[model samples]
Target: MFISVVIPTYNRKPILEKCLKALEKQEFNDDIIRNYEVVLVDDGSTDGTLEWLEKNKEKFTHVSCFSQNHLGPAAARNLGVTKANGDIIIFIDSDLVVTETFLQCHADALIKGEKKLGSDRLFTYGAVINTCNFDDPTSEPYKITDFSAAYFATGNVAIARKWLEKAGLFDTRFQLYGWEDLELGVRLKQLDLKLIKCPEAVGYHWHPPFNLGQIPNLIDKEIQRGRMGVLFYEKHPTFEVRLMIQMTLLHRILWGILSLGGILNERTLAPILQWLINQGKPQLALEIARIFLNWYNVQGVYSAYRDMVKN
Candidate 1:
């Protein structure tokens, strides 16, 4: 099958160049795979991603660029899928630098899964290793925190285009920050689609090292994720959805105690977090910051749920 590696990018030109380069170097020539195209949908980036792509057009031989207003990733991905010319759709983020055999691994796994399951009702989920090493993202080793139990995430996953269309693409109303991908996963689950883990299709997800400077944006993202999570629950309205959104009493109490009832917030924990950063432990600092971050999410989820109830 022809493959489309669809990536929805925001203002991430530097890593995006790396992402495209890696995809261009893929070694995919299996019987199940024909050829691949990189469908890059820019979500109205201010960082001149399009211009950079134009300048380095010769570098990326397999990329087809598209753009839309800053309508968030859901809309961007929808546009990418619509414009794609492949039967197999591989969803990955622009910051994820993949290995040369990434596509091959996914293709092999898909074929094996179909044969074993007696049907093509399956998708392949790849491993995502988070890293702060921009110079060589793939050099970073996997950590426990990188272990995700998510059934489906847009980070590194491949599925047939027909399944996505049948399940209905992401809800554009999740215009905030998160849960658009997993919401679609829920629908795919209802269609009896199984997830086959493909660990060989590794992608290193790169982000900047944690610092006090990033606290505001990070917190804002959690809140936005919470709001969008409420939209996810509204669409499904199941106990599992509530648990996933952290909208339940257990999550509320857990985060409340962990954050010391919201008193251990960014301002109060600044010294500790800064100390951890100064000690060259940004990862630990980020983990500590998650205390208040999770509190904000639980609060935001409940607040949105309350607003929905009132309306």
Candidate 2:
């Protein structure tokens, strides 16, 4: 069987190098995975990503790069899926550097799962360990915060091409920062797709260490995520979707209280965050920053919801 590792990239050329390098080192049995390709879709990256990849084409033997306009991951991923030649499609982010056993683990899990379930009606989900260690992301161990119960996140998931086409791929309406993959998950669930957990397959998700300088961009992403969350709920207007989008009073009250009614904003917490960073606890600082970040999300969700109602 052949596999296609589909990755959508924006302006993330630095870690994309590591990601492609790691993918080139994958080892697997010929029978399990006869061949594999990396379908990398460059979503209008301004950082010369496509040019660099082209220049280093000889280095990334398995990589096939494509370019598109500044559309979101949903569109980029759809283009990748539509153009992929492999029957099995594994979705991962551009910043994710995976283990050598990543493809083999997914293949093994898929084979066993299909046999046990008596059908090819399932997809394999792998573990994603988040880290700030740019030099060596995989060196970081799994933490409680890294545990994800998401049904169909794209961080590390492998599925048959047929099911994704049937489910209509990703909704391009999700052109914002979040909820695109999960929205596709809702559609895949409607098609009765099963989730097979593959713990053996791991991917190290790389992100820069948190600092006070990043607060603005992080906050903007949270707000954008909030806007996209409402779009997700609109597509699937169910209680579960509402909960996922944080359109509930519980979320509102929780974030509000934790943020002290928006008083503990980035401005107010900048000193403490910088101090923690100086103390070499940027992760903790990020956690504390989440207090206000989540508040911005809740407010953005409600504001977008209100605007939707008005329109």
Candidate 3:
């Protein structure tokens, strides 16, 4: 079976090169690799990324490069999927390095029927290994799982093309970052599709510390996260059982209060708080407000009271 590897990249040229080299070393049979195609979606990077891809196109015959305007990673991935010609689709971030057995392990799982879910085939599974140190003797490898709300790490997973078609692709409305994966995972669960945690299918994620100047962007991320929280609760109200989902709005409120107290590191909380406050309490809005304020043992009584009056 052909495996389509979709890699979404921004301006990280060095990291992208590392991931490509690892792909070149897959231990899977030559026939599989020959059948497999690597689709690189460049999300309108200004770092000469397109030129680089053009220059290196000869290195891999199966590598297909595509470019689009400055859309987010989620949109870029959807574009890649449209161009893919494989039965199974594997998504690996441009910042990760895979083991030689990466493809082989996931393929084996599917073929042997070792992992599945309900009446649907088990298509999606996690494969990221995030560690503090890459070479430290004491640093052990980490595997991604859905044991908790924070389980689905980034885009280092594989899924069947049919599954993507059935469950829908990544939500493009999540313009920039955060919560898109969680939203997808939630949808998969609702569809009764199992997302297994395959430790043997491993890859190392190289995440560097953000620079101080990137704080604004980080805050913008949190704001987008808060917005996603709003959408998430609207879609899956049952997600209240998940701590991350439960605390979604409250987390923003807490951060705002903490910022006011001069104890928080992020500065974008104030704007986010102001935005949420302006969203006026509909019934669901009032519920979220009460939940947000109640988490801090604050008086949500007035907001609830106001909501009742308005309604």
Candidate 4:
């Protein structure tokens, strides 16, 4: 079966070139390569990426390039899908180094699966061999049986074209980052398409060293996080579940205030607190106030007040 590898990249030309080179070394021979195509969706890269693609276009036979406005990766990927000619789609981040068997494994799995409705193939999800060396390999891949829209690794995932068409594309409402994959995975499950965790189909993720520039604008990022939280609650509404989420946000807020006062060093606390405040949920705000003895709650209130001033 032909598989189209869709790589959505933005301004990371050097790494993207390496990614393409890795695909060139796949275990699948020229016949498979001829059958397959690499769709590089350049999402409005300003880093001479167009020139780079022009320079290397001849190096790979089936390489095709598409350009669009900087509408983030989700939109870029949706565009790539529309242009793809293969029966199956393998999505690998531009930062990853794919193994020779990567594309072959996904194709083989679908070929091996039992017959299903509409399409005879199943959706295959795989884990990235994280170069950060942080993930616990001992953890088994578990079935996602909840409405939380839980998904396995996003770095290396494959899906049949029909399944994607049925499940619908990633929600562009998510805009740039976070939770779109999980939301789509939920929709796929709801459509009764089986999602299997293929642990063997591995790729190396060269996680870049931490840089502050990679961080989004603090308030804007928190607002997006709050928006995701609100969307999740809207999708799966339950008093207990909502309470738990609010409490988690409250804890993060309290911890953040404490850390700012030199009482703690939990780095994520501040952003978490900021997100809760941005949520603007009255009940959540009241809960935050009640749990932290009014003092820290007042601090959060004042912090938010200061943020508005800065804006």
Candidate 5:
């Protein structure tokens, strides 16, 4: 089947370069795979991504670029799907770099899954190896932190285009940080769609090493995720949704205890975190910082939920 890889990016030109380059080197032919296209939707990037793509279009022969205003990824992805020409759509982040055999592995798995299931009511989720090594992301081994049990994440997944249309795509209201994809997964699950793991289709998800300078941004993201979590629960309103958003008493008590009721916060933990960074263990420092980061998330969720109830 033909495939359209949809990527929604915002100010991620450096990594996007590696992503597109990897796609351009896919080891698939037009016979079994039929055809494949990379549909890149730039979500109003100020990093001159559009101009760079235009000048370097010859490097990516299979790429088709589009642009939108500063709408969130949900909107940008909707535009990508609307413009895609392939029946099968692959969703990936701009920061992910894949192997040359990535598409072939997904295609083989999809074909096998369709044959085994007697229908095309399944999506293939690939393995994502997280790495802080930008120069050689693909060389990084899989770590425990990279393990994800998510049913459907946009990091590296392939599905029938019709299923996404049936699920009505992502809700634009989740424009803050997270849960937009999982909310759509809820609808897709209702439609009896299955997720098939395709371990061979590996993608290396790249991010810079954790540092003290990134603490503020990471905290802000957790807060945004918390607010968006409330929106997710509002749409689904199921026990599963509550657990996913961490709106339940279990999460509240857990984070509260871990953070010592907000006493062990950024201010209190700054010295320790900085010491870890100085010791060349930024990853460990980030992990330790999660104690307060998650506490902020729990607090933010409850605060937003309370505001919603008040209104």
Candidate 6:
């Protein structure tokens, strides 16, 4: 059971270094996982990522590097899948640093699941603990905010290569910030693929602590996610998709009430958010900022949907 860990990275060289190091340290049974390779697809990063990887190739012996123009993760991941030589594919973000037992845990889960289900008609979803501790991301304990209900997110997951091909891979049209993975999950669900939860296989997703300076980038990401949500709905046009994208009246009313119809935006919340940051409560500030962020997403999705309809 050779494994190809497909990682799509942009300008995340710092954390990507940690991610690759952790993968290099994975402890797995040779019988269970004959060999594993990290298929890293750099999406045209101008940050000397390629040069560094090339220079440090001796250190990352298990890594095979690929590169593309700045085509976003969807396309980068597709390229990885195409280039992968392993029958089993594990998808993880470049920012996620994992335990040494990560690959072993996923392999054990897959073996058990295949035995129980009488076939390999499933994928393993690993736990992702969000951490702002860049210095030691893997040391952070899991928090409620880190919990995810996503069936098939790329942050940490492993699937049989054939299943992904059967599901037709990810839609590159979701070229924006979100929903590309979940959109593919919808199709994989239709193919009767099961999600085997592997809590033992954990990855610590590292990001810099939120601050007042990040509000604009955060808002822009929300807007991009919203636009991609519309594209997701166009392809899957179901009530489930509508709910997932928060395109329904329920989301509109909920975000509207929470944000007071956009009055509680980044501009209005800057003072309070900055205060929280100063008080060493960046996470709290980020959560509070979500009120307006969600509103922006709701509005952005609706606006995109309207534009799509008009055209």
Best by lDDT: 1
- lDDT string for model 4 (1-311, tens) is 67888888988886777678778777863343346788989999999988987977877676789999898787888888999998888887887777678777776666555443346645777656544222322132322321123353357788878878887887776674445666666677777777666666776665443222323343344445445544544565555434433424565565466545434322334454446656654224323333333333334334443454476
lDDT of 3 by residue, 1-311 (tens): 78999988999887777677778777875453346788989998999888987888777676888989878888988999999998888988887778878888777766544324334456546456553343431133554331333434446677778877788988887675566777777776667666566667777777553233444554455445555555555566564523454344564466457445333333333444345446641223223333333332222222332344476
For lDDT, candidate 2 versus 6, the one ahead is 2
Candidate 1 backbone collisions, by pair: none
- Give the local distance difference test score of model 1: 0.95
Question: Can you write out model 5's per-residue Cα lDDT over 261-295, one digit (the tens) per residue?
Answer: 99998989999999998999988999999999999
Q: How close is candidate 1 to the true structure, as a TM-score?
A: 0.99
Cα lDDT of model 1 by residue, 5-94, tens digit? 999999999999899999988885656678889999999999899999999999998999999999999999999999999999999999
Worst 10 residues of 3 by lDDT: 296-305
lDDT (Cα, 0-100) at 23 in candidate 1? 93
- Using TM-score as the yardstick, the better of models 1 and 5 is 1
Query: In terms of lDDT, which candidate is stronger, 3 or 4?
Result: 3
* Candidate 3 residue pairs in clash (backbone atoms < 3 Å): none
**Pairs in clash, predicted candidate 5:** none
> In candidate 4, how many Å is residue 148 off?
14
**What C-alpha lDDT values do all the predictions have?**
0.95, 0.94, 0.64, 0.62, 0.93, 0.94
lDDT by residue (53-100, candidate 2, tens digit) is 989999999899999999999999999998899999999999999999
Ranking by lDDT: 1, 2, 6, 5, 3, 4
C-alpha RMSD between model 5 and the true structure: 1.1
List of clashing residue pairs for candidate 4: none
Global CA lDDT of candidate 2, please?
0.94
